[model samples]
Target: MATDVRVHLVDDNTPFRDSTAWLLETAGFEVHAYPSGPAFLAEWPSRRRGDGAECVVSDIRMPEMSGLQLQDTLRRQGCNVPLVFVTAHGDVPLAVEAMRKGASNFLEKPFSDDALLDSIRNAVAGARARGDGAVDSEVLAKLSPRERQVLDLVVASKPNKVIADILGISIKTVELHRANMMAKLGVRSLPELMKVALGHG
Candidate 1:
């Protein structure tokens, strides 16, 4: 769906990287495949020049300079390029850490093609909405008190039922408040909402 979008695919495994690149290219994305994080990082500055929807999809574990390190390096340099990590089941803790550090998303190994594509699209969109600015305080002010409460819980990764119980409201009411909060924040999906909640968009 995202025609001509640029995607940087980073992985140590030759086969996986090649296959993923092929898949993304077939889906109309312009992909640059790299064998390691450092390899990708070395070429990132020049590639970031043009204005286009772009994101990095990197394997979390690698022999030299792990994905987390790469993310840290980028953040330290004030680069806000959205990142979507490809991780193994055992690397979930690392993935969660990456999320806390502002990664757009993470996909476990053996993920479906559609899932990866969706994550990349969402990451790029979220980054574009953010655009080196924090979420506007005036937009956040549009939320009602109840909606704000729902938003906080949602950002904490709470489920609707749990949020309802915590707020002394019904599940339906929780959903309603959540919907209103998302609408007020101008977000259409949980990932988008999360980006907003984190004050990035």
Candidate 2:
């Protein structure tokens, strides 16, 4: 239940941070809002460790100590609090790298309320099941041969048109294959797909 989750919300933008905190709190999550990554890190050790699921939801871009850098710092300190990055469309590649480094999930900016809630829930659950950003062989085996082919090209960063041309298929067919591949792999983003393909941490 939402009430069983605790979210540490970090973003440089005060309005966005407060609004997101309010949204999460409204959804029944216990939220602690931070204006910067440093602020969160400074209080991380002192923060209450609740009995239920706990995670950090942070914006990828910040003027002082970006989210990725914060994530790295946490990792170096052996902190495994699950991290869910919030990123703009242009910062997706950075978010992908965060996944490879063991972030639990990331939401694109302008994401829906349910999208954020679902991401936080899934991040906590997935972390408990297999640690963050993990893709196992069993999950990989779910893809069909065609889906696997699409997965490979997609992980290679090929656009739909290029993938279609390379695979001798129509663009729509490539899109179908790509969609199916991601579904079968249980990955929502290209960076997640690449994390699976590249065998990241």
Candidate 3:
């Protein structure tokens, strides 16, 4: 019902992208369509509002960057744009993982137009509740690139050893960066940390 919200749609399939954009437009929502993840990312910096009150609808599988990776990149860049992933039926696990990683929602392929609209409505509402993605972007902008990278891994709820292994850093180095990020973000505990981190995307 929120007609003013902008929906950014990205899909490798030209027909799917065009059709979905048309469907969303017909529903009284404004939409911007992109052919691929990199293409969208290239434009987002100039297009996003300072508050980032936008939602992205992307296919789960694309040529260069998957929908999941797009979500991660947004988080890393501090955009925190709400995301609704489109997935094949068999990619339900990927959808769930996207949700676990803070995607707004997911729609199965060949979904009813109503289903996608409903998901967009929910995403827009969530963005309103989250204060329009402004705080996250500002807070993350204060961190260095390395800190943001560490925070990205940290947001996955990974442990120190696991994070270090994944990033190819020593455990002590990971711990140091973790401590630095928490202090930089003014969070005193893990629960608080997760609250501030996951509260964004």
Q: Highest TM-score: which candidate?
A: 1
- The C-alpha stretches of model 2 lying farther than 4 A from their native spots are 48-52, 131-201
In candidate 3, where is summed lDDT lowest over 10 consecutive residues? 126-135
What does the lDDT come to for candidate 2? 0.78
lDDT score, candidate 3, position 165: 57
Predict model 1's lDDT versus the native.
Answer: 0.81
Q: What are the per-residue Cα lDDT tens digits for candidate 2 across 1-201?
A: 679788999999989998899999999998999999889988888884733378899999999999999999988987787788999999977876776576766778999998788778766654544443355768768888778667655643457875676566899999888888888877789877766665552
- Tens digits of per-residue lDDT, candidate 1, 18-137, equal 999999999899899999988888888888744538988999999998999999998999888888899999997787678757777778899999989888876776566556445676
Candidate 1: list runs displaced more than 4 Å: 50-52, 132-137, 142-201
Per-prediction TM-score to the true structure, in the order listed: 0.72, 0.66, 0.64
Candidate 3 Cα lDDT to native: 0.78
Question: Ranking by TM-score, best first?
Answer: 1, 2, 3
> lDDT winner among the candidates?
1
Instruction: List ranges where model 3 is wrong by over 4 Å.
Output: 132-201
How close to the true structure is residue 118 of candidate 1, measured as C-alpha lDDT? 81
The CA lDDT of each predicted structure is 0.81, 0.78, 0.78
